[model samples]
Target: MNENPHPTRQLEEAPVHDQFDVTLEDADLLGEVELTTNLIIAASESDEHLEAEEIDRILGVVPSPREDG
Candidate 1:
């Protein structure tokens, strides 16, 4: 009389963590992740691959080996 075909199968709740173990040092990494995600989204909107200027602009915003010098 069960509506579900797989009535024997039971679903379990996923584990939840109220707190994260992030540190101040992780802020820079998180920022980079945000930037990269935005770049990916913007690139997906365009039909063609990233242009030289666009690549340069991204590189300019992000830290690179050249910046270390």
Candidate 2:
């Protein structure tokens, strides 16, 4: 076994923000997908009444999707 102060593997810090993808798609279903996952958050009209996109189209209101129970 190697016991050295220097790590055999390198670690990266302060990653470049541009390298991350932050685009939301239209067909993304609100429930299954997490808003904070994959550095992207999708927003669209809420199916409050199950009408689908009839009203209240999501537009970064909360940076996450809210499903009605």
- RMSD of every candidate to native, in Å, equals 10.9, 14.4
| Candidate lDDT (C-alpha), each | 0.75, 0.44
Per-prediction TM-score, please?
A: 0.45, 0.16
> Could you give candidate 1's per-residue lDDT for residues 11-59 as a string of tens digits?
8999886578555468788888877887888798889998867866865
Residue-level lDDT tens digits of model 2 in 1-69: 778897687677876788567664655664325533321333233233422342224333333577889
lDDT value, residue 50 of candidate 1:
89
